[model samples]
Every structure is written in C-alpha cells, then in structure tokens.
Target chain A: MNVIEARHLWKEYGDNVVLENVSLAVKAGEFITVVGTSGCGKTTFLKLLLGVETATRGDLLLDGKPLPDEPNADRGIVFQRYSVFPHLNVLENVMLGAELAASPFWGRTFGKRRRAIREQAVAMLESVGLGTALLKYPSELSGGMQQRLALAQALIKKPRILLLDEPFGALDPGIRADMHQLILSIWRQTGLTIFMITHDLKEGFYLGTRLWVFDKRRHDPQAPNRFGATITYDIPLGHTDRTTLHTIQQSLGANHD
Target chain B: MKRLINQRPSRAAQVLLGILPFALLLLAYLWASELRLAANPNDKLLPAFSSIGEAIWSMAFEADKRSGNYLLWVDTLASLQRLGLGVLLSALMGLVIGVANGAVPLFRAGLSPLVMALSLIPPMAILPVLFIVFGLGEVSKVALITIGIAPFLIRDMQQRVLELPEEQLIKAQTLGASSWQLILRVILPQVLPRLLDAVRLSLGSAWLFLIAAEAIAATEGLGYRIFLVRRYLSMDVILPYVLWITLLAFLTDYLLRVLTRRSFPWYYNGGKP
Candidate 1:
C-alpha cells in the first residue's frame, strides 16, 4: 500500500477554490518537492497533507485508511518561520514532543523518564549539529541554526511523514547549502516520507526524488476564481534534463507574468 | 553635528534630565510655602517642608499613643495586602480565561464577546454595587480592585495569545500535543511573560481602584488615612502618604519588569523563539 493517496482532493474557502482535483499516490520514503507560483495552492496542498486543513471534497487516505481530520503524531511539519517554540530552549524544544506524549496533562516528565527524554533530545540535536547549543534559546540562534533546531524539533517525534513548507527560503545561500546536505543525510538515514515545498526550483530539484508543479490548467479571465490549481506535472527525478528544466521554468515565469 | 532625533544624552546627563522637573517642582513648592508662611505663620494650605518631614518621621517611626502601631507601617501593610491579593487573583483569572478565549475556538466564540463587553463596562461604576453585595469591608475593597483591572488584563492577555503565530499551534498539534497539552506546553509558556507585562500595565489602574475602595470604606489603609486627615486639613500627612504610594507603585512595576527579564529572557530579546 502507498504511504499516502489522494483521490480528487478539492479545497475551497467559500467561493474561492484553492485546490481542485489533486490526485496522487506517494510511496513511502519518497522525497516529493512541490513548486509553484505565489498563489498556486502549493502550500494549501501541503496543509492538506499535514491535516491542518481539511479537503473540501475527496478521499485522502493514509496507509489505506482515511486521513485523520486533525494533525497527530503520524505527521510532523516545519514551517518557514515560527516553527520552534519560542519559550523553550533547544534541548527543551526537542524534548517537548516526548514530554507531551508521556505526561499529556502536565506536558512534562520527571525523574528517569525526563532524563531519557533529555538524552534522546540531545542525540537528535547532535545529529542536526546543535549539540553544543542545547542551552541557547531559539531567539539567540542565527536563522540557519533556528531552522536546524526546528528540524530537530519536528524529527524528535519520529513521525511517519515529514512536511517542510519552504524551510530554507529565508536562509543565506551558504547556510542553505549546508542545510541541504544535512537534510539529505537525515532523510537517507531515516527513510522518512518527506514532502517539501520550495520556491527555489534548483533546491527542489536537488533534494527531491520526485517533483510536482502546481498550476491551473484552466484559466478564466472573466472569473479569476472560477478554476483552481492542480498538479500539472509529476516528473520522476534522477532523469531530469536541462532542456526540460528550462522549459518548465519558462512556463512558470510566463504564468507569473 | 547630529540632528535632534539622532542625539542621545549620556547616562549621567540622562539622570540629570530626568530629575530636572522634580527639582524645579520642589523648589517652586518650597518658595511658595515660605512666602505663605511669611504672610501668615498659621498657614495650613501649604505646609512647610519641615512640617511634612516631621509628619513622615512621626507617622513612620513613632508609635501612636492610642493604637501603639506605626501609622505608616500599618497603612502600608493593609494597602499592600489588599492590592497583592486583588492583583494575584486578577492575574490567575486573566491567564486562564485569556488562554481559553484565545486558544480554544469554542471558548473564544462563546466567551470572547462576553469578556469584551465586560472590559468595556466601567469597573468604577460598579463600586457601589460591589459595596452593597460584599458589604463595606476588606472583601468589597479587594473585590473592587480585582473587578476593575481583571477585564483589562484578560483582554490584554487574550490579544497577546491571539497575536502568537498560528503555525506554532499547528506545529504543536502535529507533535502530538492534545488540546490541554497545547495550552500547557505552548500557549501558557509564551503567554506567561506577556501576562506579567499586562499586569504591569494594569498596576496603575489597580492602585487607583484600591485607593478609591479604601477611601470609601477602609479604616486603616493609606487611602483611608489620607481621606481621614483631609477634614483636619492635614496636608503634611496626605503629601507623604501620596509620595509613599507612588514609591510603592514604582517599585512594583520595576520588580515585575526585572522578573520578566530574568525569568523569560526570550520574551524581551526579539521573541524569535
């Protein structure tokens, strides 16, 4: 069975249809990267997968079962900003997931359980190159470091699906390069099904095993919101050529214009 | 060569500038009092600085012959206790209701408008009602203070919680946080420092309500003493009591500021976390 399967998914906010007829089957361990124009509903699709937004109409199945209406431990998401808890330190941020799971009411664990959570959080942070910065708050870290902390915080829960909403779009190029390498290594080791949305086409191409382009196949100039966006391209990576990339880029630019 | 907007005084200059107005006011008062005294040795309107000094010394240090209690200390303790209890209760209610109304949609829809309406109602207008309901005692006084400022604190805390990024809540939910857990781990921690801020802002009004309540009904509070001496035209006692109240309010605000900075450093430092 596929890890995720969406059949004719449609999301509309009142009359404004955001996503329409988005159908796809994602196998486990597939790193799917989504790219689109600013209002092309890529983020909406990601929200649906994370279960933050429900589909207006369609069948979204997880492991051959209906997707949960709300977010849960099965899915983990890291947004571009405000992803990490501002009040928690680095280690505490990572430990929060386990703590909430263990002591649902108090959101904390004491004694041996807490020590175990600390060790696990430390190891997760160490994997993300934040071992030395465990005591630092998210505000004290640089943008790159904060995103690293966010990633560690998300991954600490051991979710089956990892979702990234333009996680590196705000970082400097040099730092983004390092983040790319780190994320790739983590993905390879975990074999987690990852869905990442990126504005940077090159970054998307570099990190994804599969690439999806969200664009409206039908446009109505008289009624702009008449048609919603759909997956116009679902290209399997590893065989992507320069001409195809240039063609897609030109089309996207034309759509923007 | 810097423009006025760009110019900033040095630390010592800043201190001097801050004290300049108070110094000028004191000098003017002293000169006026001296002139009034030269004209009439028994002038009661503007008491001489020495008389005010003596009043402070006597009230604060010397035990009263009738009660054997230092009037200043007794009044200070009574006022502080009422203000402390009222503000503590207000903070607790504000945090719980604010978090509930801000975070939970059902609670927000049901209670936000009610809280909004309550905040709009003048807390002073209901002072008489409170007196009738709770009797003319410490309960009425403390209840007045709590009712006066709690609505504002609740509104402030709710606004702060609402202003928090939606992504944080979503991220917390994805991390397996239940509704209660989300409030405990995510919303409560973030709102606590902000709650301190709201309480600090509301302290001025809290003091106002406390004084008003005490002036009307209490027998031993600072406000009661001030109003009591007004009949005798005791400007000396009134002035010192007013100054002491101002000092206490300033110290409370300063201590709350320091506590917020020390306890939640991230709250003041850009709030990026």
Candidate 2:
C-alpha cells in the first residue's frame, strides 16, 4: 500500500502561492526528498502531506485513508530547530507520542499504559545512540546530541513514516553532515519511510530514494486577510535520481552549497 | 593573572561571595540607622528600628496573652490564604484567557489590546472599585489581587503560546491529536516554562497588591495587623511582616527556578532573561 498519496494539492496565503499542484505518491519504506530553492513550497508541501496546513484545493491520503485535520500519533516529525520540549527530559519527549498512542487518555491516571510507552522510548533512544542522554536535557547536550534526542523522540512513537522538515538545516556544516549519516544509519535499521523537505541539494541527493522538485514562487500562502500566491512547479528528478548528486551541477540550479 | 582569573569559584563559594555585599551593608546600615534614629525619636512617620522592634515584641506579647499566639500564626496564615487563592485563581484564569487569545484568531486580534491596557493601569487604581464591588470581605482582597495581576500573566502567556511553532503543533495534529489533546499536551508543555514565570510573577504581584487590599478593606490579615501596629507607631511589627512577605516571595521564586531546571534539564535557554 502507498504510505502517502497527495493529489493536485494547492496551498496559498493572502499573496503567496506555496504549491500549485503538488501531487506525489510515497511508497512504503522509501526515502523521498522534496527539494527546491529557498522559498520553494517544499516545506509547505511537506506540511500539506503532514496535515499541518489545509490544502486550498487537493486531496491528501495516507495508507489509502483520508488524511487528518489535526496531529496524530501515527506520523513522527522532526524539525530544523531542536523542537524538544524544554520542560521534559529526552526520555519524556521521546515517550510522548507512544504514551498518547497507547492510551485513549494520555495522563497520570493511565500509569500502566505509560510503562509500555517508556520501554519503547528507551529502546528508540538507544537505537539513536542516546541511551546515555535519556536523563540529560536537550540544553545540556551538544547540537548533534540534541538532534539525536529529537530523532529518538520522533522514532520512539514508532510512526509509520518520519517527516523531517530541514531537520539539520540549522546545524553547522560539519554537524549537519554527521547528523545526516546518523539519521541515514538509523533509517536503514528501522526501515521506516522518510519524507524530508529540504532546500539543500547535496543532502537531498545523498539521502533521498526519490526526489521531487517544487518550483520557486514568490507568494505568501498563509496571508490571513487576503488570498495568497499562486502555485508553480513539480519538476521530476530525472537523471539526478539515478546518478550521484555530484554529477548534476545543472539541477543544483541556483541552490548553493 | 590569567591563570588566577581562569580559576572559577565553587558554587558554595560563589553564593558566599554573592551575599558578602548584603552582609557588609547590614552591619554598616545598623550602625548608621542607630545613630540617625537616636537623634530623631519624635519622627513618627518612618518609625525607628528600635521602636518597631519593641512594638513587634509587644504585639507578639499581646497575641500570646490574649489568643495564645495561635492568632499570630492564624493571621499570617490568613494573609497567605488570600495570596494563595488570589494568585492561583489569577494564574489559571490568566493562562486560560491568554492561551485563548493566542490560539484564536479573532480573540488574538481583539482581546490583546484590552488586556494590555488593563495590565498598564496601576493596580491600586482599581482598589476603590474592588471595594465597591466585592465589599471589605476576604473575597474582596483576593479578588482585587486577582484582577490586578491576572492581566499581566495572561498577556505574557498569550504571547508565549502565540509563538509556539506552527510546525510542531501541526506535526502533532497530523499525527492525529485532537484539538483538545493538542492543547493539553503540545501547547501546554511548550508554554509551561513561561507560564511558570507568569505564575511566580503573579504570586509576587499578588502579595504586593495584597498589602493594599488588606489595608483598605478588612481586618484580621497580615496586612491589617501591620496597619494596626503602624497606628500605635510600632515599626518592628511591620518590619517582620514585611520580612516574612519578602522571604515568601524569594523562596517561591527560588523553588520555581529549581523546578524549571529539574524538569527541563535539556532546556537550552536562548532568551536574554
């Protein structure tokens, strides 16, 4: 079954056009990267599929089911910034989704349900090499460690797919590369489908099983007072998908190192 | 010199160093004040430290003679009761209103300005109005403090909740969290640190307002007791109460900071404050 299928999706703000007709099908366990220039609707498309924002006009389905309007425990997302909850240790944050999933009511009353969730979170944190950091706060750790904590948290839920929106975008180049390797290794072991949105071509080429290009657009899709921008492109990866990204100086386009 | 500078003091030593100035000032000020107050016994406005000490001693003596000094504890408890109820009510109400304003588009647009305006008004200005509305009852004092502080807490919380990342909230929703669950889990946890600060700030402010509330409206509270002693020109009684309030505020703030540190050990604070 297709893990994700988005059809003729369009999202816009008052004067910004994020995506015109973004439609793609992600297969199970496939590592797909949506790449574009900065301000390209790559993030928006990811949001649409992840159900962060409503598509102005489109149908988004996951596992042959209707997409949800709000967040669920079924999809795990990691952000560019370490979006770890500052009030929780690495373990609690990782355990959050699983706890929610295991119980209809995620609270102190459901203490027994929490044990299973805790065990799962510990296992996922260990998988991401963060077993020692479980007791550590996100602040006490290095950037790489924080990112790993976030990954542990995301995977702890055991979501069907991982949605990453430039998860390493904010890190320094060296750290970013290290995180990419760590994430790739974790992804291999877990075999969870990954759909990451990035403007970085090199990372995209290195990581993606398949790639889609969202055309650049000068539109603000979330403008509340007014209808936003119009949609633009979905250029396929073509040979870039088959070859090492180093060979595609052309598709790298204006996107820099 | 560089090596000496590089050597950092231990935590205990650092705390000792921090208190050094206060200790020195306490000694120096004691001498200075004694000399000043000795020459000015007739000055009734700012009662002398010695007289206040005497007065506080006498009041304690009287409470012991009359009510076995359980009343002293009771009055202090009474004042704390008002503060506890006032601050808790304000914090919860403020957080609810502030979070509502932040999350809802129309409320965010409409209520933010009104809340800000209310926050800017001197809390004392509303004291008279509170008396008219709530009467000179315990409820009046508690209500006054709540009204005075809730707006600020609400405003701060609103701003914090508003700034919560769209990515994370939406990510959770996409994961299938209901709207209510999103709030209980994602939204609450994200804004908790700031909310804690808000609660602490309100608690301190509530006490500050409590003095005004207690003094004007009622009898049988710490503030009223302080006022009663002031009438007899007893500064010592007032000072201890003041000291007690200060101690409470300090302890509460310290406890909150510790709690924040304990909970969010990974909390890498980027805020300038």
Best by DockQ: 1
What's the CA error at residue B134 for candidate 2, in Å?
Answer: 3.0
Query: Per-residue alpha-carbon lDDT of model 2 for A83-154, expressed as tens digits?
Result: 676556788777766655555455322567677677778888887778887776566677777778778877
Candidate 1 per-residue C-alpha lDDT over B105-222 given as tens digits, one digit per residue, 9 for 90 to 100: 8998999899889888898899999989999989998899899988888888888889999899899998899999998888998999999989999999999999999888888999
Runs with alpha carbons beyond 4 Å of true place in candidate 2: A1-9, A21-26, A58-66, A107-112, A156-160, A171-192, A216-248, A251-257, B1-50, B62-75, B100-123, B229-248, B255-273
lDDT of each: 0.92, 0.72
Residue B128 of candidate 1: its Cα lDDT? 94
- The DockQ values of the predictions, listed in order, are 0.85, 0.32
Clashing pairs in 1: A86-B273
Task: For candidate 1, write residues A30-136 as lDDT tens digits.
Answer: 99999998899999988888887899999999999998988998999988999998898999999999999999679999999999999999999999999999998
lDDT by residue (B150-226, candidate 2, tens digit) is 89889888988877767656656544556666677777766767788778766767877898887876667788888
Error of 1 at B76 (Å): 1.1
Model 2 native-contact share: 0.33
